[model samples]
Structure formats: structure tokens, C-alpha cells
Target chain A: MSAAARRGVLPGFGLSTGFTVLYLCLVVLVPLSAVALRSSSLGWQEAWKVVASPRALASYRLSFGASLLAAAANVVFGGLVAWVLARYRFPGRAFVDALVDLPFALPTAVSGIALTAVYGPTGFIGRHLEAAGVRVAFSPLGVTLALTFIGLPFVIRTLQPVLEDLDPEVEEAAAVLGASRWETFRHVLLPALVPAATTGFALAFARGLGEYGSIVFISGNMPMRTEIAPLLVMTRLEQFDYAGAAALATVLLLASFVLLLTINRLQAWTRTRAGAA
Target chain B: MSIVVREVEKAFDATPVLRGVSLEIPDGELVALLGPSGCGKTTLLRIIAGLESADAGEVRHDGEDVSARSARERNVGVVFQHYALFRHMTVEENVAFALRVRRRPRAQVAARVAELLRLVQLEGLKGRYPQQLSGGQRQRVALARALATEPRILLLDEPFGALDARVRQELRRWLRRLHDELHVTSVFVTHDQEEAFEVADRVVLMNAGRVEQVGTPAQVFEEPASAFVMRFLGAVNAFKGWVEGDRAFVSGLDLELVAPASAAHRARAHVFVRPHELDVHRAPVPGSFAANVDRVLPLGAAVRIELSAPGFGGMVEAELDVRRSEALALAPGDAVHLSPRRVRVFPSREDELDSLTASGL
Candidate 1:
């Protein structure tokens, strides 16, 4: 046996490694590079003008801001849902557990239509909200609602297994050590849960940042307010400004990449702290 | 603190787990709840810890009724079988948890944690997490954490059940020394009889959701209270016979043994003895029966001789010291005389008074 043959534990390492790299390039890198290549055709100043336009800036704020708000909301309520599903039993528990995956299964357009019917003015919930002077559809809040709807399953699914695997004996130990229920939860349970919860938060936030279909109907695509970056890119495409659309797409992709990378670093730091503790 | 449990009965769903169990633990005494699996020993321990509520019972600590008190308010520290250390907390933090939760002064909490860490001899590893520690080290950390609050009573649920034999033995001795220094009223549950005998001042033997016997280790071993306790304490030989007047006649062999007056009233009785109490002789002797040696097993310090008599229904076993076995030079198929040194006679189950009287035979 030569040294090269024994380099990896598995046989055919070279062939498998080549195939993985080729498949990744063909499927992911090539398409992403095309967007960059198209944007680069325009001069740097022209590309900056397109991406830094006031309209584009407002879209960026709404997109990132609403996604952050929705992900935050999911981290709170989605965590509660996961906890209940993992630790308790009640009537309709199985049904509710299955319903958590609805956003993953439902078509985004159909969910958009349904959410609009329920929260739009004169609709089931919107009529009551309208009487109180609160509007949901055709607003930034509506965009957040749509994002929240799509991002819930990510948080819940990521957190469910971690919560279930937490030993109940630890809680009992805390209690028997003279800690109150709230104290036990704060000092014992929450620290163990933080890393997994942060991972779930990052996943939901990344998913919400790029969301488009459900927000189209609920957000009404109002420029300078409800228009999201994905919708802005579509608007540029519709006007036959392919370079401008690619420029905006490249900017959104880079911003998301940076944000996701930061989140990954944060997650890694938390995991190391937890492990070192 | 002394603890008293009065008729602590509990049932899970439709299955009864503890059936009217009662116990008393004096202050600073170490007691062991010994039983086989599914025998309600752990359940009883949990009930006393206030982790589980009894269907009908009262628990009192230091003469105050604590039946309705929550586990958090009971001021009892529990060390779980698996230690249950907070995986995300360092050892110092874990030990400081109780004091911190109670809103004690920072310096006081730190001093107490340091004191406990030193007491458990884990002072240097205070910054390490639970996963970084070995099983025995984790157990010591757990002990420190449990003692941090200065609890009135301590409960351990099979503390060394998860460790290997070597670590288990070392920790058992360490626990005994720690218990003496702390002098806190403590109770622990274990199914291993040897562990219970080795560590506990008194052992509470339980079976079928009830306590079969409660006594010091020496008392329980030398004088078992019931047939279950006798068999549970290593009684391996049984002889069935009918008692008449002052003697019990063996059914298969031509032998007769003295019987108590109470045993003479029973139509059928079982004589139980430990293997070491049965003596083997090379020739048939008075009050001894002839048997053929079926097998010889060599244990580390003792030799187990399996013997069988002609027309006997079951095999008989006798244990002899290795030196004595070597002196005798016994082998399989050799004829020998077997005599019992001591035996306990109890009425057989099938010959209960109701069955015997109802059949009118």
C-alpha cells in the first residue's frame, strides 16, 4: 500500500472528494458566481448607485429589521411551543405537534392568501383589529407576520430534540438543593438551553431574511415601506434592468452571508463556553 | 434532623408501588433502603424526598408535618444515581447554586462553595464541567453540590450504581468517611445487598412494596425476620418435610431433625439453611445422609460442593473453605455424608391453614 492510498480512512477518497467539489461548484458556486459576474459588468460606481439608492436602503432596513424582529419573536414563542410539546401531554397534543410543521409543508403563496384573509381588513381577525385602529396586512408588521409564520418551524424543530434530551433529574437535583422553581430554571435549565436556542434563532433569522413569496401578498409590496429586498430585486428584473437586479441581488447575498457568518461565530463561541464550563 | 414517615402509600396509575410503608430515621444515622428491582425502594425514597406525593401518608421532619411541603421547601439535598450535575455549569458554580438561589452574600456563597469543594477533595477542578470529570470525580462534585446548602437531611438514590466495581468500592469508603464527618441524617436506596451491608448502619429490606425487615447489618444477616429476608440474605439450601411433635422428618432421606413447637403444628414445613452451614463427611455418620458429589466448583477463597442423594427430588449444595476442601480432596462421583449445622423451619406456602382446613382432607 502506498502512502497516498492510505491517506484517508475510506477507500476512493480522491474520487469522492472530486465528485463532491464538482457537484458543489456546478449546483451552488456557479449560480452564485453568475450573479456576481453580472453585477461586475456594470462599473463599481453604477453598481453602488443602484444598491445604495434611498429606495434600496429602505428595502434593506425593512427586510433585515422585520426578519430580526420575527426571529426574535420565534425564539420566545417557538421556544415555549417546543417546551410544551417536549415536556407535557394534553388533549390535541399530537395534532398541535404535527401542526408545527405546517409552514414547512404549505405552499408560501397559499399561506400568504390565507394569512391575508384572516388578518386583512374585513377579514376574520382584521375586522376586530381594524375597529381598534390596528392594521396588519399591507404593512411592515404584515411582512414580519409572514416571516414569523415561515420561521416558526425552524426554531421549534431545532429546539425540540435538545429539550427532550435534557434530563429531568437535573431539575429535581436543583429543587432538592433548596432552589426555588424559578431559580432552578434560571440557573440550571436556561444555561443548558441557551446554545441550542441560539442555533434555532440563527436558523430562523437566516430563513426569514431571504423570504419572498408569503410576504408578497401580506406586505402589499408598497415601495419605501413594505417592499423587501427580494421584491425590490424582482421589480428591477421586471423593468429589464438585469444588471441593476443582479447588483441588488449580490448586495443582499453578501449582507446575508456576513450576517449568517457572524451568527455562526456567536453560536460557536457559546458552544465553547458551554463545553468549557 | 430526624425524619418520620407514617404509612406512606403511593400508586402509579393503576399499579400500586408503595403499600403503606413506614420508617423512622434518627438524627445523624445512615440508613439504606435495600430491595430488588420493582420492589418500591426507590419509590419510597422519592416519597420521603417530597419529589413524589403519596396517595395517603404523612412525612415529618424534626417533628413537623411536611406532607404538603414541596421538594424545594423541604431543605433536603438529593444526589441522583447519575449525579445529575449541571452540564453547563462549572463545579464551583454548581456548588454555589443553592446559596446563590437563596440570595446569600457573594462572599459567603464563595466561601461555602470553596469549603465544600475542599471537603470533597475537588478544589483544583472547580473550573471544569461535568463532562470533563471521571465518574468518581463527578460523584464527589455531586456530593459537594448537595452539601453546599447545609441541608438538614440528605438522600442518595443508588449513588454508586453506575460506577465500575473498583470505583464503586473506593467511593463507598469515601462516602462512609464523609458521612461520619458531616453527621447529617441520611438515607440511600440500593438493590445490592453487599453495598447496603457494607455502608449502612441499619438496612431496611423491602419486597413487594412492603418492608420485610429492618435491622442493623449484623442483626439482619444473623437473624433474618422472614423467609424472604432469609433467602435474600444468601440462604441457598431448602429441605421439605413434615413436622410431628418434637421432630421434623425429612421426606426423601432417612433423617430426622429437632423442630420448634410452632413448626410441629404445620402439616408441611421447609427448612432453609445457608450453604456454609451444611457439612460434608467422607463416611456416613449419625444424623448425616449419604450422597454422591455431583460437581465441585472452585471459588476464589471457598469451594462449592454440589451433592445429590438417591431418590432425592432436588440437588443440595454445600460450601467449604478452600483449605478444608483441599484437605478432604473431594471430587465428582465420590460418596459423602451431608449434615446440616443450622436450619430455619417455616410452613410451606401450599399448606396454609385456609387451604388445609377448606379441603378437609
Candidate 2:
């Protein structure tokens, strides 16, 4: 077929392509490049020195570390929640399923306050944990907890459909072929679910990295201890330290972008592993 | 091994799927459970394979009871209609799965897999994934995987149903040949009568979750036990009337259809005349019914002529060779005489009692 005939079949391709490029440039590309331009006002050496400061490096460690830890924990618990919702039926099952998305619907600052109230030194369950010598509300652990709460919806939403779409016949085939129940799960079911689970993990991890509103109230913001990267950028901006703020923001942006790019490459590999299984 | 099922019953969520089904298969026989959808053929197969437990039944293999055994313990191989081959695994790995699960030596697994790939004529595609292969190739891989452990019994549920017609025909012949060579007791479920007859030594016809008849293909087709069986193996003309003694009186036509010796006296009767059994002629003959030709369909090997008899509510079909049709010069609106060479008499079904709705043409 000629190009015009082919194009006629799907009439709005050029319109959609132009609209997508224009919208993406306006919303995302321009803002990201503006941040880069702002950081370049301080020369490369000056920006590098600002990002390499002890306070900035400490904040990076806490922000990235807590986000990584929280996302890993979410994969395990979120996967369990998704499987239960997808595979089982009980009284109030629908209510439990709806409850999983509460984190997404709640305002992030409200989540921060709510989590602080629940995990503060004198709160319910927190008093018992405090007596057991585990301080939570004003520690780095609190920041991880806040990130975990906000990141859970991403994993559960991504994984629920994948778990529900799995064919029960494949499991039966494995059983009749003399595989044990555990064998069927480990060999057949796990392989089919891995790609979707990986995708969910990546989304949750990325969300956790950019998290700020929920962590401020929980994390005490102690320099070189519990302070996170986004809080450092905000503090620099508040103090009229524009160059310092730009440097910190640029470092964080690069780290998130590189993490997302690597994750996409890994997802492509897992997708091939999980197809049709 | 010989297998016997005694009074199997199953219900899904208070809905009865199988009601008191039972059967027996001698060793080395390839049997088919043939029926339409929802006839409990697949459910029965699952019960026999130990993948499903009957609400009430006892399944015995080689005179040993294994009703309580799990599917993994029963050691029966099953293939599904959709070729449930693992998508992530290569053909070689899929075939080797069962042996590997059993912790067989690596060398033995490899050798057995190679042999099975050869059996299915898919050795050349051993390294290919299930998605990379065609439907026929994937199903062949499923078969090879099911055969890996050499289970005493093999059960297949509509194994070739997902393939195209041409490929289904080829696989049907291939499965029959494989059974002949191995002589392993096998049971396959199918909705296709032709495939069942072609592959199985004995055909068990089922309806409404119960076995209607069990016999060789020739016996079931030639001597149907019930009117339902006769109607199911269709393309035959049914003439409804009444049976008295050894003769059936078709109300519209003056001809008297001779009833079989096994016929029973009934208020409403049906005489089944296959298309090939009706001999068409140009001249009016004694014991022949007069009919007007409605339409003629050329079916390659044989020509099928449809006739609407005067006073009859439904059309009667007659099939003859190409030469016979040409000689008679049959056409639309032509007057023709038909004499049935053979007919089977059975009580007409409830709907067939009023001939208008029987054909549904």
C-alpha cells in the first residue's frame, strides 16, 4: 500500500504525534532543562563542590537509602496484598481491595501528619515499640516508614491485574505432570508473575525517591543523620542559597533519571522472560 | 493398564455436571469420550486423571484402587486443548520438565527428551520457545511433555481442537498411529465425531452428563441405540408418523417404511433415512414417494438433492453420485420419485412429533 493509503487508515497519527511532543515539552522537558540551566549559573566546579558537601552527601545517603529499603519492603508485602485481593473472596474482600488505594487518594501532607500521629513516641503501639527500645517517629526509620506508606499503592495496582490474569490451567498442567504444589508455584506461577512484579517495584521505588511531604513530619531532619535530599534543597532555597539549592536538586534529578533508565532496561529483559508463560 | 470407573457423580456449586457416570477400558485400548460441550467429558477425564475428585465414585487402575490419590501421585499425563506448554521454556525443556521434577539424572532426561522430540517430529524445533512455534508445533510439544514420564495412562482433553481443520486431521492420524505403536491405554475427550471415530478403538457417546452408548465407531454409526444418537450423527431425513407392529405409516406419503426388528410400538414414530439411503429416480415406481426437487447441492464426491414431498411438512434429502444426478437431469422445481433403500425406525423426539420445527431449516 502507498503511504497515503496507510496513513488514511489511521487518520490522526500526525496530529497525535505533534500533540504528544508539544505537551511533553511544555510539561516536563522545559522544566527539567530549566533546572539544568539554573545549576549551570554556578560553574561546574562550584556546583560539584556544593553537591559534595558533607551535609548534602549525608542527605543523599538517607534519601536514597530509605527509599530503596522502603520499596524493597513494599514489593514483598504489596505482592501479598495484591495476590490476596486478586485470588480470594471473603466477607469485606471488596472493602479490603479498596483500602489498598487509600495512600494514593490521601493528600501527602495529611499522610505525613497521620503517620506521625500513629508512630509518635506516645501514640498507640508506638509507646510499646518505644518501651522495647525502638524509637520511630523522629528517626531515619520513620522516614522509611513514611515512604513505604506512600509507595504501596503503585505495587498493589500494578500486580493485581497480572495475578488475576494468570491461567489456572497452567498450574493444573504442572500438577498432573507430577510437580508438587510448591514446585508448581516456584516454577510455573513465579515465572509468569516476575515481570509484572518487577514493574510494580520500579514504580514504587521511583515514587519513594521523590517523596518529601510525608517524610518531613516523621523524619526529625537532623543534619548528617535523618535529613533527606529534598528537605536540604528546600532549606537552601529558604535561606536565599539559590546556587546550593540548584546543585542539590540537579544531583537528585540525575540520580532519579539514571535509576529509572536502568529499571526500564531491566523490565525489558524480564518482559521477554515472562511472555506467554 | 485396565481402568474401571464406578458410579462417578460430580456437582459444581449445586449444579449437576456429571451424574452417576461409569465406564471400563481394557488395557492397550485407545478410547474416546465423545460429546457436545457441557456433556461432562472433560470433567470425567479430570476425575479419571485424579485432577478432580468425584462427589461419589471409585476409579480403579489395573484392578488397584487409586481414587484417593492426588494427581501428582496418580502419575497420569494430561494435555489440554490450548496446548498448555510453558511459554518461557524451550521445547526441549518443556518435554524434560516431568523427568526433571522427579529428579532424574540429567543425561537420562536429555536422552528421553530427544527421543520424545523425535516421536512428535519436532526435534528440529527443540530450542524454540512455545510462543515462537506455530499452534500445531506447540500442541506437539505439549504431547511430548505429557509423554515424558511414560505414565501408565494418558488423558487428552480436546488436544487438537485449537488447531486449524487441516492440522487437526493430520494430528488425528498421527495420534492414532502413535497409539498403535505404543499400545499404552489412553483416553481422549473430543466434541468432533469424525476425530473420535478416526482415533479411538471404542467411542463412548455422552449426553447430559451421562453415557448414552459405548461401542466401536462402526457400531455406533450403523446401529444407534437411541433416537438422540441417530439425530446427533445427522444429515439424515426424519419422517414422522406412527408405528404399528413391524411397519411405520408416514402420514403424508402412501409408502410404508419397514421397521427394524427391534422397533417398539409407539404413538409417534420417526423413520430415519440417510441422504445416501434414498434412491432417486425419474419414473414413478411402486413403494416410492413422489417429491418436488427443491434444491441440488454438489458435494464433490456425491450430489445432494433436496425434495419437498406433497403433504409432508418438512423436506427430504437424497444423495447420489454425480453420474446418477446428471443422468436424471435433476433441477429446481423438477418432479422426482424417491425410494428409501434403508431406514431405521425409532420413536420421534418430542419436537419432531410436529415436523414443522424438527428440521429447523
Candidate 3:
């Protein structure tokens, strides 16, 4: 009805958004555009050559592939953890709930050392796995393990509120209508959880895609296999090949931006269609 | 199908909710469990539907014990106070839920869904989800979904409790007609006396987790079983009184009576007078107490007059015909005389009057 639909959200119009835009430009836009501008010096063909080399493609495989696998794994276990913390009461539940966010608070380098010591071949759980001939530390699997650790809190934080808000009466109604347990879950509970679960999955996946520090100790920086895109970026920066590193960083930046925009659209769509919490 | 509940007892954290309650519901009759809030009416309905289990006792469907069965196995359709329709599903999908879960033929599910939507007069809105509909419409959808499998018994827990007054009145009539058409053995829980009396074939009055009285609407309304029933059914003016040696003396109103031998002695007593039971006369008649008119309020066809005798405990309320109000021509501060046509005397433990007022239900 009015041109300024967002006018009532806060008192000021020009002052609020103008200040916000200036802060965002200084904090994010200027640095990100500097990378894009620097990357243009190599020209498109030379940049493609650097990005499409066999070793570069292999790192991309480990980066995108392991991140996807880690996110898929987090969704299942994180959903269960959220359900338990939200719906049940047990001894030490509060402690367990607070522990879910430990990865977010701890320094990344500290966690990297701690994770390597725990999952190394000579470590406790690692020795048992070594007997089963499964190597986790210093492998792509280890990279995935690190991503899963960092990405878990996003999934749990997103799904927990949605689970808490679910109406138990819906399940009761389904049961009284002659639905078995599996039928009730499939038809009622799963459909209700889908939108929230998708949002959680996207958030965790995007987080996993950009993870660094901890992955270096676990992945061992193998040039053709376990090496990830961020490590390769570090490798070029250490060698002072600034333009080459900027091009790869720009690729990662665009991917993260596209994911963030998709998540935004998804949230707006869900709020309209399913009344998502 | 008929339902029989025998000595059912339920408790939450050792606090008794339903205490050894028993009931009998005849086949194909719509019965209402009516009481104030927290009176265990809904708990009894849940136990009957097999949604909740009793701590001790049994529920029977058609004389067969179903106490051990789950709600899904009992075939009793339940509608909650809030319509529990799946928000993600369309109206047609919600109505067809039970049939599809049972793996019925696809064509049969579609046909039954259509028929139910038609019965509820919501065929046009079948494609819309539950969130898009109005409150009355959503409740109608819930009703249609509950009736999808043609359940042998229907249990509704305050089905229209959340609706506004006008919508509640319309739904009450529609439910009565639908029950008449289907003739399924039905039980509904309600705190509203009017809704129960209008829609139910029989009414079961419960209080403090026990069945106080059960009878047809006219029987219970015309003849209440106890002091609680009388107070719960209508507006009453309770006066402090005492009973001694087969005689009861009521304070304030200057009245006394030799009641039954059961009330020969009591710690405290009460004399209850319903609003309609009081007779307000313009002239001072013999055997009537003198009172002063405090206020006059017109209630549609009837006019209510509030009067206060010089020594009365509280103001007395009397309902009179509109014509009689015009005849008496009473106003505030006007002198009047009033007497009760009927009164009930109940012996109680000491301080019962204060407790009754405190427990304003």
C-alpha cells in the first residue's frame, strides 16, 4: 500500500540503511572486491588453467566432495541430538546441550591439534580403527571428520527450536486415526520437519565448505589427494603468487555468496508456504 | 458401539485426577461429560478413546475389554480442542489419512475423502492447507478427517471450545444433526452446560473427579442431584445458616425450617436459592421478607432485579417476566418484598461457604 514498506521496522530510513551499508562495505564488500580486481590481472584463460590443473581439480574434489559428505552425515546425527535435547529430560542434559557449541568457541588451531592427537593412528580410538584397517587421521576421511565437528552446531541450533515447537497433538491425532508408528512418522512428523531440516542442512553445508585450520592437521596436505582448496590458497600465498591465490579465493567467495542467497530465498519461501519457525 | 468404564483411576505424580470413576454409555447415543475445568472430564474421554491408560481399571468397547489396546487399534476417532490437522497436508490429504495408512484401495480413499468433504460442506476448500482456513473451517476439516474411516466411536474433547460464541452456536447445531445421521456411539467433553444440553442425548455431570449425576437434559436441569450440581448449573445466592435438632436457622434473611433428620446437626450449613426461585412482589405480603430494590437489569424477555434486605448476608437476585417488571415499576432504592418459592439446605464441614466462594468455577 505504501512505497516504504520497511519504514516502520525502525524509526529512521536514510540514517539506518545508510550506516548499515557503509559498515558492510568497509567490513566485507571492499576486501572481497579487492580480491576480484586482483584476480583479473591473470586474464580468464590463465586463471582457468590454474584452477583446472589435475592437482587443482583433485583438491576441488576433496573440498566439495568431503564437505558434502560431512554435511549429510551431520544432518542425521545432529537431528537426533537436537531431538533428544529438546524433548527429553535426563541427568547432565544441560551439560550436553552446552557442549554442542564447543567447536564454535574453541580456537581452531587448538582444536586441530586436539583432533589430530585423538584420531591419529597411535591414539586410543584410532588404534582400534587401525586394527580394522581404516585410516582416519592424515586422509580425506579425516578432513570430513573435521568438517563434521565444526558444522554440527549449526545443524543442532537450527533444528532444536523447530523440534521444540512441534505439536505432540499432531502425532496423537495421527495415532487415533489408525496410523501405525512408521506411518505416523512418515506422513506427519517427517513432513513437518522437512523445511527446518533443509535450512539446517544448507547452513551446515555452507559452513563445511569454508572450513580451514583444523583440516590441515587431519588432511596432511597431500598434493594430489587430501590437499583442499584453502590449503592450496595458503600454499600460493606463502610462495608470494598473490594473483593466483586471489583467483581461487574469488571462486570460493562466489560459491559462499550464492549459498547464502539461496538460503535467504529458501527461508522466505518456507515462512510463506509452511509457516516455518 | 457402547462404551463401559469400570472403576477407572488415574493420577499424575501421585496426585489423584480420576478416582475410581465408572460410567456407561449406551449404543449410538451422543453423551457429554460436563463439568468445570480440571474436573477430569477430558481425562475420562481420553481413557475411553484409549489415548491414555488408567492406573487401575478397564475400558470396554461393545462389552469387550479394550484397556490393553492402543488408540490406533481401538477404532475410536478423536478430535482435540485444537484441530490437529497436519499443516503440511491439504484438506483432502488430511481427510484421507486413515484410509491411506490402512493401505486401502486408492479409488476407495478418494471416494471416501470426497464423501466426507461433502458431508462437512467443505468440498470447495479441499485443496487448501489447514493454515489457510478460518477457525470454524479448520474445525470442520478436523471433524471430517475424524469421520473419514467411519469410526465405530467418536470422542471429541471440547471440539468447539476455541471458537467464538456465534461460531460455537452454529457448530453445536451442526454436530447434533451429524450425530443423528451417523448414530455412532459418541462421547464429548465440555465445560459449557449450554453446549452439552443442546447437543447431547444424555448428560453426565462430574465434579472433583466423580460423576455427580447422569440423566436426560431436562431431568438434570430440572432436578439437580447435589448442592454442587445446583451451584454449577445456574447462578445461586448462598446464605450462612446452621442446623440443630432437625431444625435449620438461616442468618440475615430471618428464616428457619425443620429439615430432614439427616441435617439434624452440622458444623456449618448453607441455604441456596436460585435466581429464578425468588418471587418479588410489589406489595408487602404475609410470610415474605422486606427488601429494598438495589438495581433492575433487563435480560431480553426477562428482567432481573437485585434486592438487599436490611439483614441479608448478600444481595438477592431475582428474575421476573418483563410484564411483571413493568407492573412492579421497581427502581433503585425502591421498597419491595421478596420470598423464595424453593430453597435447598445443605450441611457442610465448617468454613464450606468461604471455600465455595474461593473455588469460583
By DockQ, who's the top model here? Answer: 2
DockQ, candidate 2, comes to 0.74
Assign candidate 3 its CAPRI class: medium
Where in model 3 is the C-alpha error above 4 Å?
Answer: A5-20, A260-277, B242-248, B252-268, B349-359
Off by over 4 Å in 2: A1-15, B252-266, B348-361
lDDT of 2 by residue, B1-361 (tens): 8989999999999978888998999999999998877778899999999889999989999999899899899888788878788877788888999998999999999999999999999989988888888888888899889989998798999988888999988989999999998888999998788889899999998877788889999999988887667766657888777766666667644445553435455557767889998899888877688889999999998999988996655688899999998899899999878887877778656543211123342
Model 1 spans > 4 angstroms off: A1-20, B244-246, B253-261, B308-310, B350-361
- Evaluate all candidate structures by whole-model CA lDDT and list the values in order: 0.87, 0.86, 0.85
Worst 10 residues of 3 chain A by lDDT: A268-277
Report the error of model 1 at residue B114, Å.
1.2
Q: Each model's DockQ?
A: 0.72, 0.74, 0.70
lDDT of candidate 3 over B1-361, digit per residue (tens): 9999999999988877798899999899999999888778999999998888999999999999999999989988889889899998889999999899999999999999999999999999988988889999999999999998888899999999999999999999999999999999999999888999999999999877788889999988777777677777878877777766555556534444433426545646667778887888878765467788889999999998888876667588899889988988888998877887676666765423221243474
Q: Per candidate, chain B TM-score?
A: 0.92, 0.92, 0.93
Candidate 2: what lDDT? 0.86
Error of 3 at A254 (Å): 1.9
> What share of the reference contacts survives in each candidate?
0.87, 0.78, 0.78
* Interface RMSD after interface superposition, each candidate: 1.5, 1.3, 1.5
Instruction: State which candidate, 1 or 2, has the greater DockQ.
Output: 2
